[model samples]
Target chain A: MLDKALSGSSRYWTWVIALMAIIGIGFVFWVQQMIEGLTITGLSRDVTWGLYIAQLTFFVGVAASAVMVVLPYYLHDYKEFGKLTILGEFLAIPAVIMCMAFVFVDMGQPIRIVNVFLHPSPTSPMFWDTVALFGYLVLNVVIAYVTFGAEKKGIAPPKWIKPIIILSIPWAVSIHTVTAFLYSGLPGRGFWLTAIMAPRFLASAFAGGPAILILLVLLVRKLTKFDPGLKPIFKLAEIVTYAMLVNVFFVLMEIFTVFYSQIPGHMDHFTFLYVGLDGNTTLVPWMWTSTILAAVALFLLLVPKLRRNEKVLPVACGSVIVSIWIDKGLGLMTGGFVPTPTHHVVSYVPTLPEIMITLMVYGVGALILTVLYKIAITEREIIEQVK
Target chain B: MAKSTRRGFLKLAGVAAVGMGAKPVYDAFARRSAPEQPTPPAEALTAKRWAMVVDTRKCLREHGCTDCITTCHLVHNVPDFGNPKDEVKWVWKEQFEHGFPEQHNEFMSDDLRHKDVLLLCNHCDNPPCVRVCPTQATWKREADGIVMMDMHRCIGCRYCMAACPYGSRSFNWRDPRTHIAKIDEGFPTRTRGVVEKCNFCAERLVRGEIPACVEACKAKALAFGDLEDPESEVRDLLSRHFNIRRKPGLGTQPEVYYIV
Candidate 1:
C-alpha cells in the first residue's frame, strides 16, 4: 500500500513536495514559538486560546463525519456506500492526526504532553477527549487497514470487524461530544455553557464533514480509474443538506434564546462577536461573513436544481466547509473568552506565526491524506459506478 | 507495523476502549464515593484553615496606595511587563463593575461604584480551577484550602484559567524572567507557559508569617487569620461588618471577604 503511495504521477509528486516544504516551514515557526513562548501569538491574558484550539475543535468535527458513511452502510445495509465507507474512514486518519497536532503546537509546554498520560484524571473532560480522539484514530486506522487489506487479498473482512464497526458508531459520537464538553462544562463562559452544544457540534460535523468526503471521493474519481458511483455521492449530498439545515436551525435557536432571554452574561458573547463590545467590533466583519456564507450555502444546498447539478454541488460543498470553518474555526473557541472572566472585552488576532503554524498542520494533514487515498484508490480500481 | 490476524486486532480494540477504560472509570467512581478531597501534606493539616478579610474603608483607595500590590509582586518575583496584554499580575485593583458584573447596577453610590477594589484569588472552598485540572497540576489542599499549583506538572493547558470565574489565574505569556526588572533572589521565577496565581503566600504562612499584602497594608485594611477560629482577627472583622464575597451566589465559597 505504501509502495503504491510512492508510485504517483509527477503532478502527485509535486503536490507531495509542496506539502513537505510547508511541513518544514511550519516546524521552524513552531520552534520559534517555543523559544519565544506563546506571546509570539496574538493570544493575551483575556483571550487565552486563539487559532490552534479553534483548529482542534474544527478537525474534531471532520473526524466524526466519517461515521455518516459508516452508519448508513453497516447499520442500514446501504450497498451503494459499500465502496465509499473506506474513503470516509481514511479521511478521518489525517483529520484526527491534525486535531492532536494542533493541540501540540498550541501548548505552552509541548514537552510535558507526556503528563496527560502520566497522570490521567478521568474526572477531566480533556482527559476523556484524549481517550475518545485517540481511540477513534486507532479504530479508523485498524478498520481501514484490515478491510482494505482484505479487499486487496480478494477476501471478506473477518467476522470480528462487524462488532468493531458497530462500536465505532458510538465512538464517533463521543469524539465531538467530548470536544464540546471541553467548553460546555466550563462554568462562566455563557457562550459555550448550553445543553445544546454537543448536539450543535454533531450537527455541524455531519454537514461539513461528509461534504468534504464527497469532494474527496469526486476528486479521486476524476484523478484515478476508480469511480465510487454517482448514487453514493448524491446520497451523501442529501445527508449534508439535511444536516446543514439542522445545524443552521440549531444556531438560530441559540440566537433566539439568547436575544429573547436578554440575560447580560449570555448576550455578552454574541454582541462581542457580531457587534463588538464597547465599540471594539474586532470580529464583527468576520462574524457577518460567516453568517452570510452560511445562508448562501444553505440556499445553494436547499435549491433542488443547484444541488442536483454536479457542477454546482461541489460549490455548495465548498461553501458548507468554508461557512462552518469560520463559525467553528474563527469565532467559537476565542469568542467564548470575550467579556473575559473580569468582564473585559479585549480581542485576539492570530499573528503571522500562528497562521503559519495553522497552515503547516493543514499541510501535514494533506500529505497524510494524499498517501492514504492513493493506497485505497489503487486497490479500489475497476469498481462499477452505479447510475 | 507488524501484521496481525484481523480477528486478533479487533479483539484488542474492544479491550482498549472498555478494558483500558475500566480502571480509570472505576477510580473515578471510587473517588466520587469519598466526600473529602485528596489530603494535603502533614504540615498543612497542623495549621488552622487560613482566610482573609479586606475592609474597603481602611484600604486607602482615595490615597491611591499600591503598597500591598508592590510588596506582593516584588516578593513573589511577579514581573513588571509594560505590555498590559502580557501582564502577569498576582494581585491588582480592578473597578467594581468589572470585578462584580453580577452585581452591576446603572447607578450606585460614588465611593463603592467608582473605586478600584483590590482583587486576587478568592481561594474558594469549591475551586473550579482545581477540579478542571487534568494533570492534577493544581489542587486545593484539604488542610487549609489554599489552591496550589505544581508548576512542574502543568502543561500550560490554561483550562484552569477558563474555569476560574474570578479571572484569578494568569499565564506566563512570555519567558516572564525576561520582563522582571530585577529578579528577586529568594523566590523561584516561573518558567513561561505554566499558570500562576496567589497561593495565599503559602510559603510565608508556613514560616509563621502572614501574607506580604497583609503585612504591607499601611491602612491596616488587610486582615489574615484562620477562618475556622472564632478569635482570629478576620473572623472578628467579618462579624462586625456586613462584608461580601465576590459572586457569592456561584457557591464557590470564596474565603476572601470584602467589607464595603
Candidate 2:
C-alpha cells in the first residue's frame, strides 16, 4: 500500500523542485527585508499597516471557515462530507499556519514575539488576537489528531472527542469574530469602525475559504485517483453563495452610510478609494476591479446552472477569492489612510524589497503546508499497509 | 571670667526671643501630622477634572512655541527625520486650518495664513486611541487623567495611530538612534516599530516639573495645571477667557484645549 501510494510520475518531483526554487528566491528577498527594515515596504505613517496585515486578517477568516463544513459533517453525522472532511481539516492546518506566518513577518521585532506572552498587555486587541490565534491553532491540531487517530483504529471517535468537536464550532466563529473586532472596534478609522464589520468578515471568510477548498478538491481529482464526490462540493458552494451575498450586503451598507450622511470623515476614505481623492489615484483601479469582480462572482454563484458546471464553478470561486483578497487586503489598508487626519497625501507603494519579503513569507507557509500534508498522506499509506 | 560668661548667656537668652524663634518651626511640625488626619469630605477631594484651555486667538504665528515641541521630543527621544517620508513626531505644530478646519471665519485674513497651533496627544477624557489599543499599551491615568503610552509593551501594530482623530501619535519606523549621531546624554532613544506619542511629559510631571513643551513655550501660550483646582492657573485662565478645543464634537473632551 505504501509503495502504491509512493508510485507517482516524475512530474510530481519536478513540481516539488520548481516550488523549492521559487521558495529559494523568496528567501533572498526576506534577507533584504531584514537588512533594510520596514522602510523597504510601501507602508507609511498614514498607511501604517499594508498588504501584510490585510493578508493576515483575510487568511485568519479562511482558516476559521474550515469548521463550516467540519462541524456539520462530523458532529451532525452528515456522511455526505465523510470522505472530504479530512481534507478540509488538513487545509485548515496550513491556512492557520500561514495566518500566523504573515503576522510574524509583519512584526518589527519578530524575535521578541514571545514578549506578547512574557509581558501581556490586557488592553491590547493584538494581545487578544494572539490569544485567539494560538487557541485556534491548538484546537485545529487536536481535532485533526483525534480524528486521524480514530481513523487509524478503524472505529468511532471516543465520546469525549464529541464534546470537543462540538465546542470547536463556536470557537471557530470566535477566532474570526475577534479578528474582525481588531479592525471594527477602532473608533477613528472610518472605514473599519462599523458594527457590521465582524459579520462581513465571517461572510467573506466563509465564501472565499470554501471556494478555495472546492478548487483544491478539483485539483486532487485531476491529479490522483481519489474522488471525494461532487455532492459535498456543491453543498459547500451553496453555503459559500449565501455567505457572499451577506458579505456584499454589508459592503453596500457601508457605502450607503458614508454617502447618505456625507460625513466628511467617512466620505473622505470612500472618495480616496473610489473617486481619487486629492489626485491620489493609485488605489482607484484596484478598488473598482474588486467591486466588479465581486459582483460578477456573486451573480454567477447565485445562478444554479453556472454554479453546477465544474468548469464555471472553479472560475467563480477563484474570482471571488481574488476579489475579496484585493478588496480586504489592499483596498482596506490604502483607503484607511487617504486624506489622513492631517489632510496630507502620503502615498504608499510596495517597494521591491517589500514584495520579495511578502513572497518569502508566502513560500514559507507553502513549505510548511507541503511537509505536513505529505506526512499525513504518508501515515495513511502506512495504515493501509497494516490493514 | 566664668561669672562674666554666665552673665553674657543670660543676657542673650530672653524668653520672648526664644518663643518667637521656635514658634514657626513648631507650627510647621504640628501641621505635618495634619495631612495624616482625614478631614476633607468626598466633595472637597473631588477637585475638577484636570483640563487645558488654549487661546488660539492669542497665537502670533511665530514659531517660538516650537521650543515646547522640541524640548518634549528631545526628552522623549523622539526620532528627528529631516525627510518627511520617515518623520516620526510625538509632538509638533500644525497650521491653523489643519488644526481647526471648521473654524473658518469670514473676517479671517491672509496674514494668519500660516498661523500654527501646537499639537500633541489631547489626553482626552474619552480617548478613542485608548479604547482601540488591543494591548492596553495606551492608558489613561486616573490620578491626573493624562493618556500615556507604555513603549515596551507596544507591539508596533499602530492601531492607535489609526484611531487618533488628532493625528497625534507617531510610529518609530526604524531604530530611533539610527538618525542621531550621539544619544542625548540622559534620555534613551526608542526601539524601531513601536508607536510613540506625547505622554504629556509624564516623566517630568512625576518629578514635580511642568511638561517640557509648556516650559519651552516662549509666548507662554501653552499652560499645564490641574483643571480640577478652580484657583489653579489653568482654571483661572479658562475662566478669564474663551478657549477652544480641536474637534470638540468628536466627544473626546481633550485635555489640550485651545483658544482662537
Best by DockQ: 1
Summarize candidate 1's per-residue lDDT along B1-260 as a digit string, tens digits.
11222322343443577646655544554543445676545554234677889888788877799999999999999997898778888999988887888878878887878778889999999888887888788888888888899898889999898888898888987888877877789789999989999999988876567899999999998998888888888889999999988888767889999998
> Weakest 10 consecutive residues, lDDT, candidate 2 chain B?
B1-10
Model 2 lDDT, full chain set: 0.75
**How far is A104's C-alpha from truth in model 2 (Å)?**
1.8
Question: What TM-score, computed on C-alpha atoms, does each candidate reach?
Answer: 0.92, 0.86
For model 1, how does the per-residue alpha-carbon lDDT over A1-387 read when each residue is reduced to its tens digit?
Answer: 778899879999999999999988988998898998998899888888889999899899999999999999999999999889999999899999999999888788889886776676777898889889899999999899888888877899999988999999999999999999999988788898898999999999999999999899889888888887888999999999999999999999999999999988889999998998998898899889888888888898899888888888899999899889889977897679988877988878999999999999999999999999988887566233323
DockQ of 2: 0.19
lDDT, model 1, position B46: 34
For model 1, the stretches where C-alpha displacement exceeds 4 angstroms are A382-387, B1-48
Global fold similarity of model 2 (TM-score): 0.86
Pairs clashing in candidate 1? none
A244-362: candidate 2 lDDT, tens digit per residue: 99989988999999899987778888888887887888888988999898989998899999998999999899889998998888887777776677776667788777777677667
Clash counts for all predictions: 0, 17
Query: Per-residue lDDT for B1-260 in model 2, tens only?
Result: 11222232333443335665544544544443335666544333232355555666665465454666667767777777686666788777787777776565557775544577777788899998887665566788777787888776677767788788888887777777877744676666778877888777666655566778777767777777888776788888877787788778778888887765
